[model samples]
Target: METVDVIVIGAGVSGLAAARLIARGGRRVVVIEARDRVGGRVHTDRSGGHITDRGASWIHGIHESPVAAAARAFGMPMVEFTVGGYQPDSRPLTYFDARGRRLEADAVRQYAADIRTLNAALAKIIAGAGAEATYGDAVERALAEQDWDAERKERVREYNDRRAQEQYGVGMGELGAHGLDDDTVNGDEVVFPRGYDELATNLAAGLDVRLEHLASQVDRSSEGVTVVTDRGVFRARQVVITVPVGVLQAGDLLIEPPLPETHRRALGLLRMNAFEKVVLRFAERFWDAGVYGIRQLGDEGEWWHSWYDLGRLHDEPALLTFAAGPAAVATRTWADEDIVASTMAQLRRLYGDTVPDPTSAIVTRWQDDPFSRGSYAFMLPGSVGADHDDLAEPVDGVLHLAGEATWGDDPATVPGALLSGHRAAQNVLGIDIPVSELWA
Candidate 1:
């Protein structure tokens, strides 16, 4: 049996980050990954002469993001897109009804205002309500208190649903009202001109990473921890389980002696929302090149709420369609051709008949992937701060949990995952190293 000071499971950003920090502290560490490659959910696919990020792409907080920091350290090129940069005369986000009619500017402004109202109401409820109060309940209460007509209420619901799905990978119904607060550092967002995977690759350099090693069992004892995998068994003084929340929820790995009741309960509290991306490559750009994104208000079945013009970033005639939560779950049942066809139908509704069929298409099914059952973690209603803290708590000083889910303030982001890993490594080593020092 191979032994090390620390064993990091899942070579995603979190695991890699943990391993790097541990190794820097002169502790022996090894990373076991189920996939043949690293970057668990930060996969960048290059096919048909275009670079497409099959997993996460954006640096949500460019200035303070750990991912962005890593990118700069790696000398990776990044490009920033102005929100609503295109369509100078209209709102940055162009909204169209189901029949493809552009929503009036007044209606758009009203929707935006309603969103602010809903958020303010949610904030008040979260401040006073118990952990069980869901965002859905908040939305319902806010809408009921309003004097808007049925049409306006419906519009508000539709807009909120789309926002929840896009941001949290779930609808408002599944999101925890208190947890929905965005605590991320604010800055201009940017994308990797080459690929986001470069950040993962840069972090993984010189590390002892074992690919295609699926961990089946993790048995912790008084002395240390033992991780059983399909390939081999690894013994380490401490183990960092950085797998996705969905993988933990599936109970795919057997934790001998069972995890604590609190941890188990916390697992149930956090929900893994489905999210996927469909990349369509066209021979030529048909949409406005200056616009950063497009949102369809009345889409059938939430198949797609919005799309980003890759041409703006990579100078390629490609558009990436985003689907999350229920829509992402529904898309799992669709074949590639079906997904492409349906998305194309939606595009046609927006751009008219002149929109051409894509020369090639690729769809990502993160939910169906065994390694990652869903994209990331979201707080469900009835969750409390202690829930995430308990989930991240180390067991017996040997078992540690680290991932985006463990990152309370910044879940569902690369920086969150990386920060969680750093925290886990710090916990395991019993040392405090500033994040700036790590980047330095």
Candidate 2:
């Protein structure tokens, strides 16, 4: 049996980050990954001349993001992610009715304003009602207000419903009750110039990562922890689990002596959010003028929220599309051909005859992948307080859990994931290392 000072499971960004930190401490560490490649959701496909990220395309924030800090340290460039305004040819769009006719822009803007007001009002109600009332309940009550008109009010209700559905995989009723409406993600996000996966690869570079080794069970009852894989068994003083929240909820990975009920309950309460990316390589750039961003059809349940050009990316001129919220459900379950077909159909609707079939397309099914069941973790309704606390705590001083999902308070970004790894390493090593020192 191969033995090490520390064993990190799931060689995603978080796992790799933890392994790097622990190994740098002069502790013998081994990272076991289920997938053939490293970087879980931070996958970069270089099959063609251009490089595209199939998983995480954005760095989110440059100043605060630890992943961004690491990238800059490695001499990688960071680019500002802008959708429109620079390109005169670029036309921003508003959601249209079921008919082909575009909805009134003024009405749409007013509708959005109304929704923000309603969310504020609803927030007050939720605060007073404690955690009992669901976000849907608040929304419903807010819609009944006397300030808005009946027709416009109806539109507002429909818009809110669709937005809620589009934002969360579950319905509006699930929001605040069983889902996350209170969960706030900052709108200002950044992207990596090279690729997000480069950060992961750079972090894992020089570290010992055992690829294609999936940990089936973890036994931490003895003095050391035993990680069981199909190929062999490895022992270590401590184990760090950085798999997705969905994988933990699947209850497939066995833990001997079993985790405490608190941690188990946290796994149930905290859920993984579906955020997928589709990379397309076209023969020619139809929207060739500027940083073109195209919003896919079925914006109601759209899998493709928006696509942008790779001009800032000097390597390849491809389009990277992101799918999140309710739109991600179909994409999560979509087959290879189905994904391409649906995307092409969406492109046809948007660009008419201009959009051509992609020369090659790469679809990443993180949800379906056994190693990582979903993109990343998000707290559901009723998941705050102790649930989030338990999710981050180490078990028996032997088995430790850390990942994007376990990052409480901090936004679930790549930087947070990397920080979570460093935190987990500190827990295993029985040291309280500051975040700044870890990076330094």
For TM-score, the strongest prediction is 1
Q: List, in order, the clash count of every candidate structure.
A: 2, 3
Worst 10 residues of 2 by lDDT: 82-91
1-440 in candidate 2: lDDT tens per residue?
Answer: 99999999989878988888788788999999888999987887776556677776665435465665677677767677633211111244434443334446675566557767776777666665546656677677877764777766665565554445434444466555424433443443467666778777777788899999978899897598999998899999999998887777786677787888978888777666665666777777775355345432233324544566766566455776655556567566667677777767766665576677888877777667776676666555665534554777888788898887777655355666777888898887777766544445
lDDT of 1 by residue, 84-194 (tens): 111112336667776677878787787778766766775676677666777777777778877888877776777766667777788878788766675333667778879
* Model 1 clashing residue pairs (backbone): 86-290, 132-382
Per-candidate TM-scores read 0.93, 0.84
Off by over 4 Å in 2: 82-98, 101-108, 129-133, 150-171, 177-188, 273-275, 285-292, 295-335, 437-439
